[model samples]
Target chain A: MLELKNVSAGYGESSVLKGVSTTFEKGKLTSIIGKNGCGKSTLLKSILGILPLSSGKVVVDGNNLHSMSRNEIAKKVAYLAQGKSTPDMTVEQMVLHGRFPHLSYPRRYQEADREIARKAMGVVGIYHLADKPLFTLSGGTRQNAYIAMALAQDTDYILLDEPTTYLDIAHQRELMNLLVKLANRGKGIITVMHDLPLAFNFSNTVAVIQNGTVVAHAEPSEICGSSVLDEVFGVKIERLPNDKFYYDY
Target chain B: MRCYMKSLPKNKIANIYGIAILLLILSAVLGVLLGASGISLTDMLSSLVKGDIESPEVKILLYVRLPRILSGLICGAALAVSGAVVQGVLANKLASPSIIGVNAGAGLAVILCSAFGMIGGWSLSAFAFIGAFLTVMLVSIAAKKWGASRGTVILMGVALNALLGAISDTVITFNPDVSVMSNDFKIGDFSSVTYAELIPAAVIVLITFLVLITLSNELDVLTLGDENAKGLGMNTSLMRVVFLLMSALLAGAAVSVCGLLSFVGLLVPHAVRRMAVTESKHLIPLCALFGAGFVAVCDTLARVVFAPYELPVGIIMAFLGAPFFIFILIRGKGGHRNA
Candidate 1:
């Protein structure tokens, strides 16, 4: 389990996350949703240790994240950043980089590492495009390739920042399904999302952040029943009779 | 479905390695045999086997041509590998040692040392290394201070190159006694390289190559930008500094020996990337082999084309490298990253 207790973090001169406490349970898909500039991404970075916490502690399985080396943290948690540049590498090469923390000294990838990368690519359904350069792949397929890279890390927890951005509706649905599948495989999957319906439908737990603090942390049903999203986003969310949702600004 | 997506077949890479080694050998042999006093292949082989330094043929081969040939091979490989690492670390294809002020900086230091009559042996190379390292550090610091974008860094390098070139010219002007020597050094020639001058550089280049090859995997991960690399558990800043120091060591060592040779660093890496895999492990070795061959052949041509009146190898490299650089610019491959 990864837990952040009263954490505050931000860029220079401007705080984005303030005293936000949250726990991401293992084997569950947790969706972080909030308005733009509401510290959704900042909170993720704080937990990943990419951003230094201004106050408070982030603990992973009873060990303080701040006390561990970057390599140690990477061994337990994998991260997929949003909208990476297209490196001049094939999907297989990109996925193999995930094994970096596992190897030492000369850092040669052994047969076992290759097998794991291949399996990770298979999990994301990009096994067919492994040899193709990432620049040649479609946006959605590229997203899948990055996911394959994250999966290849073989960690218990994976964090993604807006994995669905720039992806088409079909690709978004496929990615959400893949995330849920990964969560079902006993990995804690945490993602920052903008799509309310998809987050509500797919995630086992929903964390709603407003003004740099998490105002609501509950199950999808409980969040949907409350007025959290409407209050945070300054919009009216209506639940239709047919089990669909509509948002009116 | 188990789809095996192999990027480049193993045989193809093996073939590339084979071709590169063969070319290197061919160029090396030609470099030795085609110098001013031509020695036939059989004669050269017999001289090598006889091991008689007293014989005129053996003396010329051992004392004169052998060091020049070795210098070309080592310097060419050094510059090319340095360029490839710089390009990878900066994530910019245009980031060669020559273009990024490393060669010019080393050249200024060597010229300054010569002007002060502090020439020869390890001291000159040490001075050159310090100059190269300082220039790279300055450029990186300035770039970081001023937004640190790819374009910004390249522009800063250009500015630094111009400044260093001007300083070199000033140093040469004040010391007219060393004017002729400075001119030859500026254009880059291997005729003056003796064994005494070549040994230190050779050792540094060889050791640096070995160390870099061991870290090639880390270099590949570094090309994926900082945040991503850190996410993969790499100390990205530390690796960048180490790579930059290695680049300086290579450029400084080569410049200290052969003056300021241009474009082998820029051209060889680009050419190798076109033919083989982009992975640094494969790219670094292939660049070393192909680069050695390319410069050796170019040096041989420079020696033979003008007959008794030899041209510096830099002229030939410039003629080739300038056009390719422009082509890269026109093709929009020079600046790949917005940052």
Candidate 2:
């Protein structure tokens, strides 16, 4: 479990996350949904220790996030930031980088590391695209490559920020299904989602942020038919059968 | 065609390495054998075989052509590898040693060293590295602070390059006594190179390059960008600083040896990339080899193209690099692939 204790973080002088207290449970896919500039991404970064918490603590299991080294923290959790650019390298090389946190200085990618990477690529079904350069692949395939990289990190918790942003609907759905699959395998999958209907329906729990604070954190059905989504996102969401939902546009 | 579309596989990259080594060897042989000396390659080889090191041909081969050729290789490799590193770390394609003020920084340092009297080779290289390190760090920090975009970083580099060049000119103007500030040095020539000057710079470049090669994987991870690199547990800031420092060392040592040889850094890496050499392990070593061969070949042309009256090697580089840079711009690959 990753727990945030009254976390406050921001860029330079302007505080973005004004005391955002939240807990990301293990073995479940949690979706953080918020309006633009509501500190949803900022909150994820804070949890990953990518953005320094101004006033609170990020506790992973029992270890404090800030006290740990980057690698040590990486061993505890993996992160996938938004807007991943395609670098010039083979997909296998990209996946192999996931084994980076496991290596020490004078970092070597040994056979074991290669095995792990191969396993990761297999997990995301990108094993066939292993030899292909990342830049040549389509949006969905590239997202899989990146997710494969994250999976290769082999951490208990994997955090992604808007993984579906630039991808098309089909790719987005494919990515959500993959995330759900990973979550089903008992990995703690936490993603900052922009697609409200997808987030509320697909994730095991939904974290709704308003003005840098999580105004509602509960099971999607528990928050359904409530006024929180309307107040926070300024939209109405109708819950459908079988725990699915749609925006009342 | 498929090979051109993607990063080369290990064996293909090795094959390219094979080609690069051949080019370097051919350039070195030509550099040693084809000067203004009336002595033939046969004469020099036969003399060395006979242990007759006193011959004028052998002396020229051993002393003049050899040092010049060696320094060309060292300087060329240094600059090119450094350029590859800069391009990777900053994740900008337009940034190179010359554009990013590294050459100017080292040029200023060399000029200052000359003004202080012709100091030892080590101190000159050290001063050059210090100067280059400072300039690049300033540019990097400023870019970070401003949250400069990919193109913005290159623009910042252009501005810094111009600023540093102006300062160098000012220093040169003030200290006309400094011989290194003369036209030949500014344009980058190996005509006056000595063993004392070449050895120190060579040592630094080689060592720094090897260190960079060991950290090449980190460099690859770095190109993944700050957030991903940190997510992968890399200390992004530290690795960036280390890479920048190594790059400075390389640019400095090369500049210390041969004034400011522009475009070897700019040209060789781009050319290597066109060959589909993407990762730093392949990128750095290959750049070193190709850069060395390319500069050696250029310097030989400078020496013999006009015969006794030699043009500076920098002229050849400019003649080549400027056009190639334009071609890249026209093709719209001048920015980062995704940028």
Candidate 3:
């Protein structure tokens, strides 16, 4: 499990996160949903050791994140953001960059490394574009390419910040299905999502944040109830007698 | 078009690198042979193999064009390799050492020293090195405080370039006699160089090339973007400073030898990347070979194109290279970063 304790972080003194604490469990799909600037991304970054916490501690798999090296944390968790503006890298080459933690300095790729990268591309269904330059790929294709890279890292935990922001409906479902499959295989998948319907239907657990703190962490059924929706999002929900779902808009 | 778009089978990029270098060596040899003296290939070979410097033609060839050829190769390689590093580090296609004012800074300092008559007996190179170091220092500070965005770095570079240009021009204007010497020097001549001046400059370029090549992997990570590289455990700021210093050293050394030659650094890497992918592993060696071959070819053409009155290789390169560069840009494929 990845756990954050009183973590505070920001970019150069504008402290976006204020003493937030959360734990992401293994073998589960945990979705974080919040309004704009609610510190969802900041929480993920702090847990992954990308953003240095000002005072508190983060522990991942029993290893203290602050005490360990960046490479060590990289091996434990693979973090993917919404969109990467990388240029000129082939899909295969970008995936191969994930094997960095396994390779030492003067890094070289063995046949096995290529095999893992190929497998990653296969998993993400971008195998055909392995030789295509990343810039030429469409937005959805490029996002999958980065996801394939994170998959190639083969870490225990995968943290994604709005991974489905650019995808069409079909691709959004496809990626959400892929995340469910990854979680089913006993890997922890933590994603910060803005699409409420998709997050409610897909995730095993949802953590709702408001103003830099997680307001509710519970199963989808519990969090999707009318009262929880009204409390978290400040919206009143109506349920029709014939319909099985609650609607809050 | 379908066949063309089929995934390129991975030929070992290193193999291509080796082939390009071999071709460069061959071109450099051919370049050294063809000159105004017109020594026969047979006589040149026999003298070189037999160590018979007794022949005046052989001695002249060995003493004169050999150092000049080596200088061209080294300078070309230095400029191209540094260009690749700077482009990657700044994440800007146009961020060459010259464009960023490192060359002007060194060139100005060298001219200033020569104009003042303070370097009456000293080597021009030490002054060039100091200028180069200062330029890198100034640019680094600017890149930090101002941020190394594509717009900011280039604007700062242009501003610094204008300042250096004005200072150099003012020094020349104030001292006309020294201006004549500086003008002759500024035409980018390699003909009259002594072994003393050539050896140290060559060494500096080689050392800088080695340093840059060693950091090619870091450069690969760097080009992805600063945040990505930092998350991958690289100290991004430190790497940028080191890269700028190396580029300055290389450009400064080249200027000390051949004055300010433009377009080789800018053109060579872009050309290499256009033909190949943008991976630094392939990019660096291909650049070295192509840079050496390019300058060698341009220098040869400069010598023979208007025989008895050699054109400056710089003028020839810009005249020849600029249009091709514009064509690449206009074709809407300035390689991946620009697109």
Candidate 4:
């Protein structure tokens, strides 16, 4: 389990996350949703320790996250940044880097590391593209490649920031389905998403952030009944006949 | 399948290594054989085997040509590997010791030491490394202060290069006795290199190379950008500093020996990347070998192309390197960064 207690973080002098507290349970898919500039991404960065905490602490399995080394944190949490450009390398070469924290000095990937990487790529259904340069892959496939790299880390928790951005509707569905599948297999997954319908439909838990603080942390069905979405997003959400909610400004 | 198309088979990697080794050997032999002294390959080899260090031909081969050739190989490898690391760390293909003011900074430092009559070989090399390290630090600070965009960093380097070059010129103008020495340093020739002068640089370069090889995996992670690298459990800032220090040591050692030889750093790494994959594990070693060969061959041509009239290897490198630099800019490979 990962827990953030009154975590406040910011960039330079401007605070973005002010006393945001949230707990992410294992074996569950949690969607963090908020309006633009509501600290959704900032909260994720704070959890990953990429942003220094202005106040409070992040604890993982009873150990303070700040006390752990970067490699130690990496063994427990895998992160997929929003969008990243890699150098000219094949998918396999990129995925092998996930084993970096696992190897010692004069690091060389052994047979066991290779087997793990291969299995990770297989899990993402990109085993065939392992040899192909990432530059040549489609946007959707590139996201999958990054996911495969994260999976190769073999962590219990995975955090993604806008994994569905720039992806087509079909690809988004594919990615969401993959995340759900991972969650079902006993891995904790947290993602920052903008699509309310998808977030409500697929996530086991929904975290709603407003003005740099998490206002609601509940199951999707429980969140759907409250007026919090209207107050947080500044828009009225109507329940549609097809079991979907429509936002009207 | 896409996988089949992208895979780097083991056999191909082996072939690339084989070709690089072959080129290195061929160039080294040529470097030893063809010089102003007119020693043929067969005679040199026969004398070397017989341990005939007394003959004039053998003397020239052992005392003059051997050290010069070895200097060329070491200097070339150092500059090339430095360029490879700079490019990787900066995430900009245009980043090299020469272009990013490292060579110029070292050159300025060496000239300053010479002007001040600080002529100790080891002290001179130490000064060069300090100068190179300071220059890179300045460039990095400026880039960070404004924005660390690739263009901003390269432009800052260019500005620093001009300023350091001017200072070096002023120092040389006041010290007339050091003018002749400055001329050789500026043009970058290997004719004046002695075993005593080459020893310190050779040791530094070898040690740095070994250290870099051990850190090649970390370097690969760095190319993915800071946040991504941190997410993978790397201390990105610390890694960057270490890599830059290694790069400075490499360029500083080479510059201490050969003056300001340009473009081997840029051209060799780019050429090696084209021939092989971009993984630092392969790139660093291949760049070192291929770069050594490339400069050795270029130096041999500069020596023998015009009989009895020697051209500085830097001049030859400039003629070859300038066009390639332009080509890289036009192709926009160095300009590649996500907005």
Best to worst by TM-score, what's the order? 2, 4, 1, 3
- For model 2, name the residue pairs that clash: none
Model 4 chain B: worst 10 consecutive residues (lDDT sum):
B1-10
Model 3 scores a C-alpha lDDT of 0.77
Best-to-worst ranking by lDDT: 2, 4, 1, 3
Candidate that would win on DockQ: 4
Ranking by DockQ: 4, 1, 2, 3
Q: Which stretches of candidate 1 lie over 4 Å from their true place?
A: A241-244, B1-8, B45-50, B178-181, B321-339
TM-score of chain A of each: 0.95, 0.97, 0.91, 0.95
- Tens digits of per-residue lDDT, candidate 4, B194-278, equal 8767888999999999999999999998877677788899998888889988899999989988998888888888877766467
lDDT of 1 by residue, A1-249 (tens): 999999999999899999988899889999999999999988878887888899999998998987989888899888887758777778899999999998889899987888889899988888878778887799999888888888889888999999999988898999999999999999999999998887877889989999999999998777777888768876655667876555665
Per-residue lDDT for B158-276 in model 1, tens only?
99999999988777677777642556687788878888779999998999999999999899888776777878888888998899899999999999989889888888888787663
Q: How well is each residue in A43-66 modelled by candidate 2, as lDDT tens digits? A: 878888888888989998888888
Clashing residue pairs in candidate 3 (N, C-alpha, C atoms within 3 angstroms): none
Among all candidates shown, the one with the greatest TM-score: 2
Q: Please state the error at residue A117 of candidate 2 in Å.
A: 1.6
Give Cα distance to truth, residue B102, candidate 2, Å. Answer: 0.9
Candidates in order, interface RMSD in Å? 2.3, 5.6, 5.0, 3.4
- Scored by Cα lDDT, where does model 2 land? 0.87
Tell me the tens digit of each residue's lDDT in model 3 across B87-180: 8877778778788887888888778777766342236767777787788678767786766667788889889988998888888777876642
Can you tell me which runs of candidate 4 are displaced by over 4 Å? Answer: B1-8, B45-52, B179-181, B321-339
DockQ, candidate 2, comes to: 0.53
**Which regions in candidate 3 have their CA more than 4 angstroms from the true location?**
A226-232, A236-248, B1-8, B11-19, B46-55, B112-130, B133-149, B173-181, B184-187, B331-339
